[model samples]
Target: MAILKHFAVKNADYGAVIDYLKYQHDEFHLVPILDENGNSMLRDEFYFDGLNCNPEAFDLECELLNQQYHKNQRYDEIKCHHYIISHDPMDVADHGLTGEQAQAIGMEYAKANFPGHQALVCTHTDGSNNSGNIHTHIIINSLRKEDIASQLYTERAIDCKAGYKHHLTKEYLRHLQGSLMDICQREGLYQVDLLSPAAEKITQQEYHAQRRGQLNLDMANMEIMAEGIAPMKTKFETNKEKIRNAINDIAERAKSFEEFQRLLKAEYGIQVKDHRGRFSYLPSDRQKFISARKLGSHYDREYLLQLFEENALAAEQNQAQWVQDDPITILFIKSDLRLVVDLQNCIKAQQSRAYAQKVKISNLQQMAKTVAYIQEHGYDTQEKLQDTTDTIQSKMAKARSDAKLTEAKLKRVNEQIHYLGQYLSTKSVYADFLKSTNKKDSRQNHADEIAKYEEALQFLKQHSPDGKLPTMNDLRSEKELLVQQKSAQYETYQYFRDYHRELQTVCENVNHILDISQPKQQEQKRLHQSEHSL
Candidate 1:
């Protein structure tokens, strides 16, 4: 599966990005590099276009634009944007797409997405810690090539164009992601959800930290190899994971917001603060507070509150049947919630695999049935078998069409569910902001939080104007129904696909047998005719 990571470079030299993509020396290596990963720091796969000049002279091209249009522009203005398109290592290896092919894909994507921009695309084979992930790097200048007058300009200039500046909004990013997924599907490559559920989302910082920690462990193993000593095993967790675990612990035991805050501070040394409407966590060791949303959906304020409510209700219902547990026991129970979530995910994945297996088995059985039917009905002639094959082909085509329609529907429904989920989860924050009386301080101190809440509220109002938000349960049920519909469509498509292939095979075998028997049948006819004449 492919994932995208991007950032805009402000006041940064384009040459630096080029150099990093082309050169091999790591002057400041943050992670250990394995020897087997090879010394070829840069893969020999790069592509570029739309510069109207040599790519090697891209820096000059950008500079010329700046000179022509914005010579007095601020030094801190964004000059370039760098995007990384990375694929899973196993998927890339299995697909066997060469680095050049990857580069071509990246180039096409960049050219299509960032039209009129000077861009260079490069494919890299060596990932962090020698992970062997194939990824592409696309660097494009931020300056507009066409001339136009806009609010930011008094007159049309060489480097300024109306609506040329890239807007890296959430909606825009989601569109790009969907486009990438479509490209992968067209290319018959494996892909996961680009816009995955919030629960499964992992920030880039957390991902890199986990990778770095793994590399550290790898380095320690290398040392053990050199010393000929027993290897030490130590479990490492990312900071986000640790925070998530801590939050889960507190949410499971506390019944109210105040209790939740008190227990978190007393038991975990973590401070929970509600700024305006958004909730953030500050660890005792850390001075900065991180937003709960950054951790995961489960740790988000609304979800945590929902869990507390559910726990309280369960306790009330089973008070006589339940026994009070100590803090340690409670901790163990809270930890089990994480395990349960993980187990549920595992079950879903297994169910998908089982469905696929069932499809394959059903196809085999149908193939066997087809063969038996052909023998029983004496479909010995090529014409009869050909007619049957054509019928099956028509059915297969219809199934494919149905599957495509179902997939499109599923995509739309899933997207709706995602946004609805986001709005519902952040609705409480928006409500809190509305009820707060210290508007001045709230706006000044909790600017980011307020902005997020307002954004969610705006999106909900725009998309769902009735001011009614679907409950989590309703969304989940809808999601499950859509998933089942998609799965059934997929199964139908696969069944016909496999049946068609098997029928073709059988037709070929039957044709070959008829070819061998034709001469003998002809000779027998001549012999019988001669005997009748005698």
Candidate 2:
């Protein structure tokens, strides 16, 4: 899977980014020893190019732009936005991806996204764990250097104008992710669901921490082995990994939120608390609690609780057990969600004269509004009103269902497009393998490539049972149609959700009226007493 990551570079030195891309910084940290006949050296398997600027003098060009725009002057101002697209390690073997190709892709992406900004595009094959993954680095000056045309990703007018500093928003990042996915699909590379959270999310910091820790542990293990002793612990695990394991361990077996919490505390020395509708966990070694937001969605409150409810009937049911089980009791105890309110039970309204009068006036006005609404909507009966609410809720739920289905169709189309590209691009390799007399050696040399060809062929064949595989244009056009339909369905879902909320509030108000609005004589006596008291 190709993952897209972002970083905001606030340092004033734009040359440092290019330097990091072009040279090795592992041990010497750019302290270079000149070769006999050369001034400097560049790293192996590294390709770099610039857009709207000279690659050799990116910093100077950016500085000139900054001066012209009068932006990025403050010390704390962000000078550049760094985006990295890391392809899956498997892409190298399966797709025969190269550094040059990745660099070209990065150049195209940067030129399309950051058109007005002076940008440097770099590709590396032997950096960041030496994982044999081809990744690209896209670094763009924060200030716009030209007044370029706007794109669908552009959110504001200033984004396309010169002299304005780049300020990326969440929407822009999501669009970039979508664009990255599209690029990966078109390029016949692996792609992940960037729109959703990962099952196990390791941040860049945590990833590097684990990498360094593992490296150090391997070194220590080597020394121990040199002494003819087997190291007891050869593997290293980060604190977050331990926490995640503990939480998943407890949540997989526990039946309720409380039981899960108790087991988590007793078994792992981890304390879990629901704070302001969210869960926060404190490990034994940490002073502060880490929010579930930092962790992936698999550890969040909604997911865990739902998992527990499903685990409750593990001994009996097979699928969606919670759907059959009643959650009303649990919700009434733990959740603020409710169907109705009891206005008569408000003790504060009964305690004071002025407050009582104010509440009564408000309740009378609400009751009048409720009546007017019921009459206006022709809901003359309680059952009819409730039926209307249920119908609207059902419609909202159906709209959401439609949106999910449409999104899934879009994803399928994306996969079909990817496999179609793979099928077409690898036909020559397959033909050569078939024609080669030394078939065994050829297959052994390109095992992953062979697998890629076979898997893509099988997938396309199955997807197109009629044996008429779709062309790239057909798949892309289908994707475009699905995207438009998905958006329309999402808008419909939003409209229904808003309408449901409005109707639900009216229904709750009607219930409140039912609770507080009493007989005329008794209500008059209560108001008369409150008037005298006031």
Instruction: Give all TM-scores, in the order shown.
Output: 0.49, 0.56
The Cα error of candidate 2 at residue 135, in Å, is: 1.1
- Model 2 lDDT-worst window of ten: 327-336
Model 2 ranges off by over 4 Å: 27-40, 317-534
Compute the lDDT of residue 199 as modeled in candidate 1. 72
Residue 508 lDDT in candidate 1: 59
Q: What are the per-residue Cα lDDT tens digits for candidate 1 across 220-311?
A: 88898888987756556786777778888888888888878876764456778888767899875578999877777777677778888988
Q: Which 10-residue window in model 1 sums to the lowest lDDT? A: 332-341
RMSD (Cα, Å) of candidate 2? 28.6
**Model 1 TM-score (2 dp):** 0.49
Model 2 has an lDDT value of 0.80
Tens digits of per-residue lDDT for model 2, 283-346: 8668999998788889888888889888887745643453345322112112122333244677
